[model samples]
Target chain A: MITITGLSKSFQTPYGKVDALKNINLEIKQGDIFGVIGFSGAGKSTLIRCLNRLEEPDSGIIRIGEHEITSLNKSQLREVRKRIGMIFQHFNLFDSKTVFGNVAFPLEVAGLSKRQIKNRVEQLLELVELTDKTNAYPAQLSGGQKQRVGIARALANNPEVLLSDEATSALDPKTTYAILELLRNINRKLNLTIVLITHEMDVLRRICNNVAVIEDGEITEMGPVQELFLNPRTDTTRLFVQSDQDLQLNNYSI
Target chain B: MADDLLPLLIVALSETVYMVLLSTIMALALGLPLGITLVVTSKGHISEFSGLNNVLGTVVNIFRSFPFIILIVVLLPLSRFLVGTTLGSTAAVVPLAIGSAPFLARIIENSLKEVDKGKIEAALAMGAKSITTIWKVLIPEALPSLVRGITLAVITITGFTATAGAIGAGGLGSLAIRFGYMRYRDDVLFATVIVLVIMVQLVQWGGNFIAHRLESKHHIGM
Candidate 1:
């Protein structure tokens, strides 16, 4: 479970101060698939990055379970991070590592025994259906396969929370669906809390049970996914739902 | 071409090899950490010590700006102080390594910069410490470029060894000056040049081969 309150971040550009994230408040329950939807420059990335304290907030209180994440020191933050796994839009697997090595990296950093690491990595590779590609480098894998490896690597430390930053945006439609399905399966199987952000409405609709619509660094709407889809409160959310409908009608016309 | 000259050529070539190889090893030892520090301490980087980064950067640049000939003169005291002499192939190693360490550092910094920032963030998110991220992700990702850059540095150091011969370092360049220029035997000069070219070529070839093999393994092409 994660709780965020009064978070604000700003960046100084040549022109002036740019408020990337306004005073924001959010909550994600355990075992819930939460999606944060926003267009480019809407501070979606900053919001998610702030959860892991990758992007230091100018002011905020972030609580993950009982620990106040915003107040943790360097070593304490690292300890907190062990419970939170993050994936990138680019599938940032270590290019120099084999699939097994990439998945096992977190375990090694956690100082697991060699035998434990081998067993855990093999189990992860099997879960991602990448057993055959265990020895392959990231460069050699397809985009879908690469994302699978990324997913496997994220799950290496048995994290309670997985933060996905546009994790499926780089893939094709079929691959996107497959990755979303994988995320859903992982959520159910491990009871993991997933907080994913994307600009695509389809990405939110496919898997997210609870969704927050963000615009210009503020949360415009937040509720159950189906309720928001049926009755969007803000123009941004309405446009997203309308567009999804337009896309469905266009497919029918074709 | 005579028997006496054959032995002389062999000794000079070996001396040159010794100077260049030792200096390169020394330079690498000093420069690798300097390079990593430059990148790590940079603004917005993992370490993010801009003050330290700027000061160290300026120092590396100052060392790099000096001409190798001037560097040799400037380092004369240090060379003597370090190795108990300032006039032989052994002593020349000090100036040569000091002269090229900054150059190697800059090349290494550039290669480290080429690694994707995403990789670093991913590492951090996975609870990896800064040193671990640098060693596991940053250095390994930049290794091929670093290898090629060091090859260039090695070749450049080889040239510097010959220049150092002007100061009694007893390499092929010294033999060229003593035998070819002083004694008017152009053959010795030509032979030295040919040998230097051959040595550089061999090093370049080897560097490229190793870099390609590493690139094939590590480059993600994404």
Candidate 2:
């Protein structure tokens, strides 16, 4: 389980200090696929990044499975980070590395023996179903394949929580559906808690059990995915639901 | 006359190769760490020590701005101190290396900076130490660019060797000036120029080959 309290972060731009995240609070239960939905600049990215302390919160207490993440020193933070895997929208698999190498990277960092790394990486490739593309570089793979590699790499450490920062935003709809299915399968198989942030309500509808609606820098609505989709409270949540429905209608017409 | 010129040309070509190779090694040795330091210390980087970044930047700029001809003259004493002489191909290496180190550092800095920020963040997210990220991620990703930059540095240093040769550093350049131009032997000068050009072309071709081989083949529509 992960708990965040009074989380706030701001950036100093030339224009002046701009608050990217307000005093936010959230609790993501274990084995739950929690999704945060917001438009661009809604601070969802900042909120997800802050969970890993990727963007350090100005003031907050973040506790992940008994570890007080906000209080840990640099080395301690790294140890904590190992248990919290994060994936990016761009599928940040190392371009210079083959799929095998990319998946083996975290194991190498964790100081696993070469034999252990090989076995584990092979297992991960099997999990991601990219066994045949093991020798191919990231550039050779399609977007879906690259994201699979990213997922495999993220899971290498057997992280308790997987953070997906708009992981499917770059994929086409079909690929997005496929990737979401993969994530849902991984969540069930590993019972790993997943915290994903996206602007797409279809993503929430597809995989997420719980959803939060963030507008500007604040959460305006929070509930189960179905409840929120059926009865959106705030204007931002309504806007997102309306748009998602419009997209579906347009797709059906096409 | 042809026999005499052949031996002289052979010796000169060997000298140029010796000086260029050694100095290039020296430049890489000194400049690579300096370049990494520059990038890692800059704003919002892994280390992000602005003070060190500013000081190092100023120092590199100071060295980079010096005219190569004057730089050699200025470093004559240091070269003599380090190599026990300021003449010949071996002694020329000290000044040559110093002259090119800052230039290579800038090239390396640019190459390293071009590495995707997202990649570094991914490495960090995976619990990689900064050193690990630098060695395993940044270096590997930027390798092709780094090779190209080093090739440019080598080619630039090769040109500087001619200027160094004018000051008693024995090489094709010195031979061209001393035995070829001074003696009005257009044939010797022409031969040296041809050798120099071929050497440069070979370096360029080799650099490109290695870089191309190292590059990951990207499929269309990425």
Candidate 3:
């Protein structure tokens, strides 16, 4: 379980200090797929980044299980980071390394021996269904394939929590669905807690058990996915629900 | 006559080879870490050690701006101290290395800086420390650029070595300068230029081939 309280993040701009997240309080149950939805610069990314301490909060407490995030030192942060794996919008696979090597990287950093790394990499590659592309570089893979590799890499070290920052934003709609299916499968199979941030509500609709709407760095609404969709409190939430409503209403041809 | 010319050309080529290889090795040894330092100390890098970055930046600029010939002469005392002599090919190795080291450092710094910040962030988010991130991610990601930079440095140092030859360092450059320029032997100068061009082409071609081969081309579905 993850609990975040009074989470706020601000970055200095030429104009002044710009707030990315403000007083973001949330609780994600174990094995829950929680989604943070927002428009551009809405603090969705920042709020999610706080989960892994990727973007440090100005003031707040983030607890993953019993451990508090703000209290971790450099070494302690790494320990926390290892448990909270993340995937990116661009997939961010290492270009120089093969798919297998990319997956093995975290294991190697954790001081796993060559044999251990090899076996783990093999298992990861098989899981991602990229066993054949184990020797291929990131450039050789398609967009969907790249995200799969990202998933395999994220799953390395058996992280209990996975933070996906717009993991499907770079892909086409079709590819996005495929990747989402893969993520859902991983979550179900591994019972991993997932905190996904995206501007697209469909991403949340697809796999998230719980959803949160963020605006100007604060959580404006939060609840179960279907519940939030049925009753949206904020204008942003209304917009998302309305869009999905339009799509659904259009399809029914009533 | 052709036989005599072959022996001389071959021996001269050998010296050019020696100087380029020797100085390039030294450049890499000193420059790679210096380059890594420049990246880490920059504004957005892991450490962002502004003060240390400034010191490194100033040191790099100082060496970079120093004219190699004058720097050679200025370094004469130090060279004399290190090698017990400050004249000839061996002495020339010292300055040649020093001259090229900064060039390489700057090149490496530029290459490493271009390694997408996201990759480094991804590694860091994985609980890897700065050193581990560098080893497992930064260095590997910048491998192609680093290789290209080293190749350019090698070729540039080849030119620098020829100039240093004027110092009696004794190489094809020295030979070209002594017999070709100073002695007014146009044949030897023409020959040196031709050899240098061929050597550069070879290095450029080889470096490019390796960089391309090292790159991962995106084929998403495959």
Overall lDDT per candidate, in order of appearance = 0.92, 0.92, 0.86
Error of 3 at A33 (Å): 0.7
Residue B109 lDDT, candidate 1, scale 0-100: 94
lDDT of 2 by residue, A76-137 (tens): 99988988988899998787888999999999999999999999999999999999999898
User: Candidate 1: which pairs clash?
Assistant: none
Query: What TM-score would chain B of candidate 3 score versus the native chain B?
Result: 0.93
Better of 2 and 3 by lDDT: 2
- The best candidate in terms of DockQ: 1
Instruction: Give every collision pair in model 2.
Output: none
- Candidate 1 lDDT over B96-192, as tens digits, reads 9999999999999999998888998899998999999999989998889999999999999998998899888889989998898899988888888
Report DockQ per prediction, comma-separated: 0.67, 0.61, 0.57
How accurate locally is residue B42 in candidate 3, as Cα lDDT from 0 to 100?
92
Candidate 1 lDDT by residue in tens digits, A89-196: 999888889998899999988999999999999999899898999988999899999999999999999988999999999999999999999999999999999999
Off by over 4 Å in 3: A249-254, B1-8, B216-222
On DockQ, who's better, 1 or 3? 1
Give the higher-DockQ candidate: 2 or 3.
Answer: 2
Q: Model 2, A175: alpha-carbon shift in Å?
A: 0.9
